[model samples]
Target: MPDSSAERPRRIVARREGPMLVEGPVEIVLEDGTTVSSDRFCVALCTCRRSRIFPWCDTSHRRHSPAARPAADH
Candidate 1:
């Protein structure tokens, strides 16, 4: 339990157009004071506020503009 990795702080990766990644197990406190927890190895946090699950990325940001995508080649 005295490992150096254990002494290190949690790592978080942020992206402009995507979710922010954080090393888990994490507990998130929402605006209303409710707390949510996730025990997954990695967690994706919503940045664009488009997540159906809010605070947790449901990839809703990716669906922001379906029409903006180029038409598929035949």
Candidate 2:
């Protein structure tokens, strides 16, 4: 039998240029009093303030960089 207290610790990671990564099975309470939850093994919390899916990372952080964009067709 395994000890429940010996379970691995949850982790949260912050990036200098991207979203914050958090261990999942998380719930968040928004400013509007709405609640959101995710059960993913890892969840990415938006930090760039550019996600259409606010509170979640939708790769919106990459959109802000000119190098990440494709050149326009003439």
User: Going through the candidates in order, what is the number of backbone clashes in each?
Assistant: 0, 0
Q: What would the per-residue lDDT of candidate 2 be over residues 1-74, giving only the tens digit for each residue?
A: 23538877669898887899998777878889999999888999998879999899999889786768899999
lDDT of each: 0.86, 0.86
Q: Model 1 over residues 10-53: C-alpha lDDT tens digits?
A: 89998777899998888899999999999998999999898889
Model 2 TM:
0.74
Query: lDDT at 17 for candidate 1?
Result: 75
lDDT of 1: 0.86
- For model 2, the superposed segments whose C-alpha errors exceed 4 Å read 1-9, 66-74
Model 2: per-residue Cα lDDT at residue 50: 96
**Alpha-carbon TM-score of each model against the true structure:** 0.78, 0.74
